[model samples]
Target: MPQKGSRLTPEQVGLIRAWIDQGLQWEEGATFAKAPVLNLSPRRPELPGDEGGHSVDRILASYFARYGVKTSRVGFWIDFLLDACISTRLACCRQ
Candidate 1:
């Protein structure tokens, strides 16, 4: 087949055809481009102090006030935990 202004060899064509016949199985973690080096180190973020209730609430107080987003710490944690659980379940199901 013609590729990048050049024709593929007969052997290359045969190999491609065989790959297609075999359901186009790709090698695990295989990539055409170089994968980026990620720093997977644990990080401890500086959270706001318990001056206005929860640390998250204290951090988001200005945001809540600005946007008129009325919510409780209990509600926030429940939603966050539920979302985390669902995400964890989905990830486990995929594996």
Candidate 2:
């Protein structure tokens, strides 16, 4: 589908004109499907009863531990990380 603020393609314009030429079929309750829902908030799974740590810390620790990832929290990634944090209200880089 064409994006908002974007001009309709020639094909789309033609289709609309054709529909108008056809007297515009009327169908009650005929509508496009609703857009998918978005959850802007962060979601942290409920930890086990014995787990001890903030959800953010736990998530990062688990990721690094499982994947054996290595890297200082410094460099270009940190810049992108900060931007994501700001945009997501600290959800992405909370830990």
Candidate 3:
């Protein structure tokens, strides 16, 4: 049968053909049927908040402490505001 857009290599195709030629033997008690379906419903996961701060900050606390990187909400807001102002000034200048 023609398999359009197949990604199998020549060696892999050869192996498959050999297997088919050899009567397609299977291990005892093994079947190729699909396994039972799992419950895939969406659910909110409990975010880790060990330090009583923002979930993200608490999660990254270990990383920050390990790398000696200090973090503060005030510093974050200041950097964000500065970046916004710079972007606005550049856009206005380009107009």
Q: Which ranges in model 3 have alpha carbons more than 4 Å from their true place?
A: 1-18, 26-31, 39-50, 74-95
lDDT of 1 by residue, 1-95 (tens): 33568787899989999999999899997878988999999997776655656666777777887899887674478578989999999999999
Q: For residues 14-84, write the lDDT of model 2, one tens digit per residue.
A: 99999999998869977688977998899757764355644444456657767997744424455787788
Q: How many backbone collisions does model 1 have? A: 0
What CA RMSD would you report for each candidate?
A: 12.1, 9.8, 7.3
What TM-score quantifies how close candidate 1 is to the native fold?
0.36
Better of 1 and 3 by TM-score: 3
Between which residue pairs do clashes occur in model 1? none
Tens digit per residue, CA lDDT, model 3, 10-92:
99999999999999998997898899899999997775655576556666777788899877743466578889999999999
Over 4 Å off, model 1: 1-36, 49-52, 74-76, 79-95
User: Candidate 1 or 2, higher lDDT?
Assistant: 1
Overall local distance difference test of candidate 2: 0.70
Candidate 2 has its poorest 10 consecutive residues by lDDT at 48-57
Which one is best on TM-score?
3
